[model samples]
Target: MTELVSTTPGLYPLPDWAKQDLSDLKGHQKHDLISGDEGPEIVDVYDRAREEVVSEQVDAGLDRIVEGQLRWDDMLAHPLTVHENVETGGIVRYYDNNNFYRDPQVKGELTFSGDVAAELDATSELLDDEALQAVLPGPYTLAELATNEYYDDDAAFLDAVGEFLAGEVDAFPEHETLFLLEPSLVTDAPDEDLDERVPDAIDRIVDATDADVVVQSYWGALEEKVYAHLMDANVDALGFDFVAGDRDQTLYNINEYGTKDDIALGLVNGQNTLVESPETVHERVEWTLDRIANKSFDRAYVTTNTELFYLPENRATEKLTALAEIANIPEVKA
Candidate 1:
């Protein structure tokens, strides 16, 4: 029997209360906002927000739940930017969207500072009996997003970043599923040897973790060579953005390469404002499964194409509800 799971990619929008609390703390530095005397208050707000998202996921009957990543203001590049050795600099556009993230400036040797690990610990406590899926920005994406004043060579800088991220993955022993979010594979399309370096970096990052790891790329279809490279990486699953990318091309790659691992279909559009009907979602999921049936994949995950932070909280929740409904539909095993 093929296991059908419904999950989000991560970084859900903060609830209104959390957003207001953060807004009130405006002008305060990240340290003051997250660790100053008022830090406890912000942490409490995040807790409440996480609780709400967890409850919503449970209520929607999702098979896996995430912490909603409400603390990630810079999207996936956040953990790296908040590290002690890294400095936050000017804002840069995030992929092809209107959103932006503070560019992470590497001032010294890349190292883990425990901030990301601490967040994982907190989220683990909040999971209760539910299965927890941990999410992190992929090394290649993090390296692409940062300004390197420390490493003289780009390859060395990328390898150092990969080592730093692998350390982060080592900390989350409790997560059943770990997602490495790597949008830059499609957005930036490495024109150098960094393309070959990416899969090796991903392999190193997930090598020690016992959890099932999924490398999810969004924003657009990966270049042919990059896509083939990721398909051969040491991971359990690969996710493609059918909503945002060339769906036919993605399916062609999966078919041509052969689905030797689990496949996650990004059928839901997270960046849009319109809510999809349950029937429409069901049809799309069926469409994806129909294609997978001819392939040799072991499992299928129905998910949103990207983080839901682009949509309002209510709309995001609605999309989750719709996804849950689709997941509950009886599976037609291949």
Candidate 2:
């Protein structure tokens, strides 16, 4: 029997309290204040924001819950950017979207910091009995996003990043699911050499954890070769951006390179302002499952294609409600 799970990709939008200017602090100063002892008010804002996100997910009957990544000011790059040896520099476009993250300038050897783990712990404490899932940037994506000055080559850099991320995975508390967000794998499209190296790095990061790891890519469907490579990766599941990507190509890839692991169908559009109806979402999910009936999958996760932060809080909540409704449909589950 398949499990009906509804979840977000992390990084929910900031609440009104979080967006307010606190005493005119600027740039890194603001970040420092929130992360430092001088910012209890800012910390309270994030705490309340996370509580709100968790409450909504539970109310919507989602099977899994996330920390909402309320403190990820730099999106997926936050963990790396805040490292002691890394410096935040000029802004860079985050994937194909209007969002931006400061480029991470690596000044020395990369090491795992416990910031992400601490955030997860705080959020996990807030959850009643619900299973908490942690989200982190994938190794290859982080390697591509940062400017490396200490590594000898791309291969070495990827290895270091992979090891660093594995340490982060080790630091996480007992979690039911862990999502390694890898949008760069699709948006940047690594060359043949890096393509071969990426899966190795992914394996290193995933092998360190026993939790079910889902390597989720968004913005678009992966190139044929990359798609095929990920199908054979050591991860437990592969998530496709069906909402923003080519649905036909995604289904073709799944058929061509069959998977034994679960498939997370990104049925909700996280980037768009329009909220899809329950009927439309249920039909699309069934349509994909019907085409892949011959393949063996342990389960299917119905989720948004990307981070819900792109949409307003109201639309994001509505989208989650629709996903929950669709997942519970008897025909869709059957």
Best model per lDDT: 2
User: What's the true lDDT of residue 263 in model 1?
Assistant: 78
- lDDT for each residue of candidate 1 in 200-222, tens digit (9 for 90 to 100): 88888888588888988887787
Model 2, 97-207: lDDT tens digits are: 688878888999787788888888887888888988889889888888999988998889988999999888888888898888899988888888778888888888788
Q: Candidate 1: give the clashing pairs.
A: none
| lDDT of model 1 at position 252 | 77
Report the backbone clash tally of model 1: 0
lDDT of each: 0.80, 0.81
